[model samples]
Target: MGDVIPAPEAPRIPIIDNDEAAARRFPVRRIYCVGRNFADHAREMGAAAPAGKADRGLPTFFLKPADTIVVDGQVPYPPGTTELHHEVELVVALGADAPPGELAPERAGALVYGYALGLDLTRRDLQAAAKAKGLPWDTGKSFDFAAPVGALVPAAALGDLAGRSIALAVNGEIRQHASLDDLIWSVPEILHELSKLYALRAGDLVFMGTPAGVGPLRPGDSFQATLDGLPPLSGRILPALA
Candidate 1:
């Protein structure tokens, strides 16, 4: 046999159950996202064309590189114009890579490591500017500290998350509410499609999208996201930089 190729390395994050512990470390990689999976959200974001137009087509996909993760306990709002927004979501941690194409629900479950609450922060003004120019959403959606994730809960501890309730609240006011079952494109389907384009690997995380009610944020503001059976994930938004 000739020389063998080395297997690709799996991304990894430190496993912590408390915020204090999580703050001391840096994330292994960052996989940012958008929550266009919800119909109401699609409409709110103008992604849904008029009823008969094209139905907004399909679930849109965008990406942010690995370093965008803000693991330092607090999310520092980026500088510039005011409109910063927050979208809470349920994060899926993969334990192993899945093959491309249609995957059985069971296979998808087997690949999961655990779940956590995550925030997909957006710079609304920048995003709008990009949209107006027909440019990609990178400036608006993939800013530094844009993806703030909570601790991992390990799959063995949290079983099939389908049909579970996921919600988020800001300063005691509920902003986003929905069920995992409401995802237009289910998790397995997402993984299948994503794998076809990029090899699915352990340590890779998916935001799985967010529900409607996405809006702006200001410094000193605090929020919390809760899944039916998981502990509530909370964070405080730091003032925007000068």
Candidate 2:
């Protein structure tokens, strides 16, 4: 008889709410983020913004571990960086898988479960250094407790995102603001583009992208991210644990 291998401890799967009532649970699977989806933000980052649909390029995708999600509003200041930046973004949650192969943008909207506010915390100094050396941004963007998301509202309940606004405030001052209409790549387009590279599945989260006002956070700073008609995501930066 073959002996069974002893398994280690079960990993924690972070759960997010699917509705304002918090009755349903949505376990996070993978976190996929789009880089520079906002034209203004692209320009601010020193990359040229696409002039029109013809010139618009593909969305840049990156990932962070599912465990990095922080729902409790407590963000410990990550170590190894003097500059921690806050990028407020709209978070999209998938409820179902798309058909195999390239997902058509027109059909991608059906897979959406809900939307939420999210903060894409970044280690700016590390990111800048990596960019200068033409290196990957894993260390700069993917770290412990790097994503703080708010409770989600069902997509059907929220209706169209056409007139919505996303904004972030730091210590009571507005830091980033933009309209959903300003996105270079819409939600459907992002999902469609992402499907070409990876299989689209349920429980996947996509951070749509941030606006132009990316800035720093200190140990004691507090931040708030908001998307029109949805509950705001708020958290404080505490000194890193020893």
Candidate 3:
């Protein structure tokens, strides 16, 4: 027999769902985010919007730990920020089909397992401070319960991508709305770009960025996020610890 190795504890795999198929839990590996993929949102955030395919540059990338996913509906208002913001996005879940590294854009779709709606919650004050000091956005972004996602709907079940709409509402009032076509970088393109950077693999989730109208979220605020035919995600901001 081989030598036995001891470990402190078993790793806890973060899980989402394959829609109502609760028996099949989608274990999350890592969370990859594409920043400013929506031209309107980029402009709103004081960045230049790409006018066409030729002028469109590489997608901005960032990461949030997989455990940040909040599936249970109640999201605690995070600490260290007076300005907490919400950015709803179309999330793409990858399967185990693709070999790691350097995937071509045209063939990237083959790696998709499903899609879901997610909220990319942000601490805007921290983000702005970091930006002013030319620092990384980890403090503003990656935090406890930073990514709240809905169930994953298989890629095979999705209809034409061009026919989808992504929107968000706070307390029943619409704050952001946009057609999927508005994304500067499509899903496949994002995967290809990401694969070039990381060894993109199964259980990876990509937040395809958000549209204009990202705004503040406070305690007791309830929000709803919807993607054309996928499951909608709704959550309430719980009061912060005193």
Candidate 4:
């Protein structure tokens, strides 16, 4: 054998534990996000989709690289915008192997290994400018420390989340509130649609979507994300580095 090539140094994503054990580290393949999957949220953003029912075709999605994910609220406030918004969402962590194609709803649940509450932090002003200019949302939505994820609860333990409540609070004040019942697409439905878009494999993460009441965040502000049947995720936003 010739000289073995040295591997390049790269960061891996840290995932919270469902049980009372140490967190697990996984090689994040992709960070897939569903846009405006909640009716109230869509309406707030002037989207045409309604909240209670599924819209025609697949839901809108965006991507973030695996390098941006951090466990819980360990990230500091990201720079580049005066308007940073907090969007709490239900995050799904896939564990089993899934082929590239349409995935059946019945078997979709089996592919999920765990669930967690995640914050889809965004630079709203940048996003708006990008939208107006017809540019990609990568800079607005995908950035360093953009995703603050909580502990992962094994899917078998979380079970069906039909009635679970998902909410976000700032400085101990409730800002966003909604239930999984209001989701336009359920977990399985999301997975089914996602399978058609990409060849999903083990360790891929999906941020389901957020409810209404999304708003801006400032330095010294503390935010908390909660999902019924899962551990709460809390973090503080520090001023941008001078």
Candidate 5:
């Protein structure tokens, strides 16, 4: 018989709605994200920093490691900045591995395992500073506790959400409201494009992108996000570390 090898440790995250069980059922690999995938949001960031001439066409991309996920836990306000912002988004979790190639839109839907409400916490000040210097925003975007995800609802239950409404509220005020159809690039296109760059595997998550109207947050502030017919997911903002 061949020599025995130990199994690898599981990546930990707060799992709700049998996600842990589901995760065991379907192993996850990595996380991919598309930046400024909405026209309004693109305009907002573009207006903040004009990229050469006019800003039009093509969305930016970014990545967040899988281990950064924190679910229903205290989000420690990262050090080095006071301008921490929140960008709520609809998260797509993949179920099976897809080879890097031209993935048809239909095949794209086949990869989805479930959906979740997630927060793309950002260090706005650092992000702006990086943008001014033409640097990557990973410092602001990929920090620990930067991604907080909620329970997963199986794709079968939600069906196709291409045109569903997604909204987020702070305290009681609506901060963001838009249909998934508003996305500059559809989910399938995103998956296909991403697949070309990276092989997507089961458990991989993609935070499609956020809409306009992103702003700062502070301790004691609570927020809620909802996607169409799914139940709302809520979390409180934490103060900056001293």
Candidate 6:
């Protein structure tokens, strides 16, 4: 038997519309992440990402608690790590529950509520150590304020997301840069694959993976990220608490 106590409350993030009016605070139910979904990024990691019509490697995934999300330019430099990395990505929030079974790519848009620019902050050293030991790396990716995001833009207000550039800059210097076209799997394909494995529902946020240049972070460091069709997301790395 487990401890006799009430369950803890799940954290929530405010969803403001980048286009116009603000959105209601979305109760985060779950966070799904896609890993190494870019060819060049894969190569940089010393492996090749599956591609072509015949390539059918199972999609890599991970999860973070909703409490990890932080917004409004306030990202804290977490403790217990010397190497903190920033990964710029397009965050997808689902509007409706995905139908159980294999979902076709055509219907993926119907399930999307909006999009946003998110930084998947990682403790690269801890993550690498975990990988070396064949252990779960959630400790590296799911730390406090690990997901710093910007406003959510309604899907209808956007056009083609592909071919657009997504980049990150630190202290006014560009670090990571890539086009949306570099994604190994499209948003629709990711949604389709996720639905087959997990129970997809409204308020679910999916981190669509990062591009090649993943580097370190320091206290008081400023980070600015821009996804071509989405609003720019910026934040500062706060000093670790005493």
Ranking by lDDT: 2, 3, 6, 4, 5, 1
Q: After superposition, which runs of candidate 6 have C-alpha atoms over 4 Å from their true positions?
A: 1-23, 51-53
Model 1: residue 224 alpha-carbon error in angstroms: 0.8
TM-score to native of every candidate shown: 0.82, 0.92, 0.91, 0.90, 0.85, 0.91
Summarize candidate 4's per-residue lDDT along 39-148 as a digit string, tens digits: 88988998777534534456899998777877747667788888899999999988887866789999898888888888898999999999999999789999998988
**Deviation in Å, model 3, residue 165 alpha carbon:** 0.5
How many clashes does the backbone of model 5 have?
1
Model 5, runs deviating above 4 Å: 1-9, 12-28, 47-57
TM-score of model 5 relative to the true fold? 0.85
* Backbone atom clashes (below 3 Å) for every candidate: 2, 0, 0, 1, 1, 0
lDDT of candidate model 4 versus the reference: 0.84
Residue 242 error, candidate 1, Å: 5.6
lDDT of 1 by residue, 91-136 (tens): 8777776766656655777777777777888898988998899987
Candidate 4 residue spans exceeding 4 A from truth? 1-27, 51-55
Cα deviation of 53, candidate 2, in Å: 1.4
The Cα error of candidate 1 at residue 61, in Å, is: 1.3
Q: Worst lDDT window (10 residues) for model 1?
A: 21-30
Tens-digit lDDT string for candidate 2 (53-132): 89997889999888888887799999999999999999999989889899999999999998888999999999999999
- What tens-digit string does per-residue lDDT give for candidate 5 at 1-242? 76499756545433344445655332346778888877677787774423432453455678987777777746877887788898888888887888667777778988887888888889999999998999987888888778877777778878878679988888889998889988777778788888777777887989989998888778888888889856677888777656
Q: How many backbone overlaps does candidate 2 show? A: 0
Output the TM-score of candidate 4. 0.90
For residue 84, give model 1's deviation from the true position in Å. Answer: 0.5
What is the lDDT for 157 in model 2? 80
Score each candidate by Cα lDDT.
Answer: 0.73, 0.89, 0.87, 0.84, 0.78, 0.85
The residue-level lDDT of candidate 1 at 165 comes to 92
